[model samples]
Target chain A: MAVLLALVVAVMLVGGGIFTLLAAVGVVRLPDVYTRMHAASKAGTVGSGLMLIAAGLHAFDFAILARAFAGFVFFILTAPVAAHLVAKAAHHAGYRLSRHATCDEMRDHTKK
Target chain B: MAAIVTGLIFAIVWAAVTGSLSPLNLVLGFLLGLFALWIIRRDFAGTRTVVRPWKLLSLLILFVKELALSAWRVAVLVASPKMDLKPGIFAFPLKVDRDIEITLLANMITLTPGTLSVDVSDDRRFLYVHALDCSDPTAVRRDIADGFERKILEALR
Candidate 1:
C-alpha cells in the first residue's frame, strides 16, 4: 500500500512538473499577451493544482488532504478571475494582437 | 432551508480552516455558523436557487475532462515545431443573465480548450473571449453553447 501510494505521488509530481514547464515554455513562445494568458491560466492552473493534490496525498492524513483540497479549489477559483482581469486590462490598454492573429471580433464589436 | 445551507457551508469552511473534521469541531462550527448567520440575517435575505445534485456532478465531471484536454492540447501546440495559429477575440452573445451564471460561464471558458474570457460587455449582453485558434468562430461558439454553457444552464438554472 505504501509503495502504491508512493508511485501515485511520484507520477502526480512529475506530471505536474511537466505541465508547469510546458506552461512556462508557452508563455515564452506564444506571440501575444492574450495567447500567453491562455498558456498560463489553463495549463499553469492544472500544473500547480496537481502538485497541491499530490502534496496532500503524500501527507496521508485526512485533515491535510482536506486543507490541500480547499487550497486547490481556492486557487482554481481565483486564477481565472485574475487572468480575465489582466486580459481585459491589457486589451483596453491598446495591446494589439500578434501579427499572426487571424481576426479580432472584439475590435469590431467595440466599433459598433 | 437557506439558513441551513449557509450553516453547512460555514461548517465546511471552518473545518477546512481548522484542518480538522471531527464531529465535535463540526458541531461547534455549526453553532458558530448559526450565530454568524443570525448576526447577518438581514443581508442574507434568503436568496435561494434550485440545486440539482446530479447535474452539478455532471458539470464537475465535464470541467475535469475539459481541464485535462485543454492542458494536453496546449502542451502539444507549444511543443510543436510550427504552430499554425489563428488567434483572435470574438464576442459571444450572453444567454445567461445572472451575475453568478455569467461569471461561472466565463471562468469555465478561460479554463477550457483554446479559449479565455476577456471581459463582459457593459450591458452584459456579450462576453468577449480570446481563442488561440479562431479559424472558425461559429464552431467555437457552438461548442461553448453545447458544452459549458449548456451544462451550466442545466445545473444552475
Candidate 2:
C-alpha cells in the first residue's frame, strides 16, 4: 500500500512538473499576449491543480484532500476570468496580434 | 425552496471544509449556512432557475475531457521543433443570454482546446475568442457552437 501511494505521488509530481514546463515553453514560444494567455491559463492551471492534489494525497488525510479539491475548483473558476480581463485590456491597449495571424474578426467588427 | 436547498448544500460544504462530519459539526454548519444565505440572498434574488443535475454532470464530464485534450495539444504544439501557429481573435455570436450561462460558456472556452475568450461585446451579443490556430476560423466557430454552446444550453436552460 505504501509503495502504491508513493508511486501515485511520484507520478502526479512528475506529470505536473512536465505540464508546468510545457506551459513555460509555450509562453516563450507563442507570439503574442492572446496566444500566451492560452498557455498560462489552461496548462498552467492543470499543472498547479495536479500538484495541489498531489500534495493533498501525500498527507493522506481526508480533510486536507477535500480542501485541496476545493482549492483546485476555485483555481479553475478564476483563471479564465483573470485571463479574459488581461486579454481584453491588451486588445484595448492596441496590442496587435502576431504577424502570422490569419485573421481577426474582432478587429473587423470594431471597424464597422 | 431554493433557499433551503442552497442552505443544505452550503451546510454539506461547510462540513467538508471544517474537516469533520460529526453531528455537532453538521448542525453548526447548517446554522452558518443559513446565516450565509441571509447575507447573500439579495444578490441571487430572482435568478433561480431549475437545475438539471444530470445535464450538469454531463457538462462536467465534457469539460474534463476537453481540458485533458487541450493540455495535450498545447504540449505537442509547444514541443514541436518548427512552430507554425496562426493565432488570432474571432467573434463568436452569443446564443446563451443569461449572465450565468454566458459566463460559464466563456470560462469553458478559455479552458478548452486552443481557445481563450478575450471579451464580450458591449451589448453582450458576441464573445471575442482568441484561437492558437486560426487557419480555419469557420471550423473552430462551428466546433464551439456545436460542442460547448450546445452542451451549455442543455445543462443550464
Evaluate every candidate with DockQ and list the scores. Answer: 0.84, 0.83
RMSD of each: 1.9, 1.3
lDDT of 2: 0.90
Q: Which stretches of candidate 1 lie over 4 Å from their true place?
A: B31-47
lDDT of 1 by residue, A4-99 (tens): 999999999999999999999999999999999988988898999999999999999988888888888888899899999999999988999999
lDDT of 2 by residue, A1-112 (tens): 9899999989998999999999999999888888888888888899999999999999999988888888898899999999999999998988999899988888888889
For model 1, how does the per-residue alpha-carbon lDDT over B9-99 read when each residue is reduced to its tens digit?
Answer: 8998889878888999988888999999999878646555677889999999999899899999999999898887899999999899887
Highest TM-score model number: 2
Worst 10 residues of 2 chain B by lDDT: B1-10
Given candidate 2, what's the lDDT at residue A27?
Answer: 96
Error of 2 at B150 (Å): 1.3
DockQ of 1: 0.84
Number of clashing pairs per prediction, in order: 0, 0
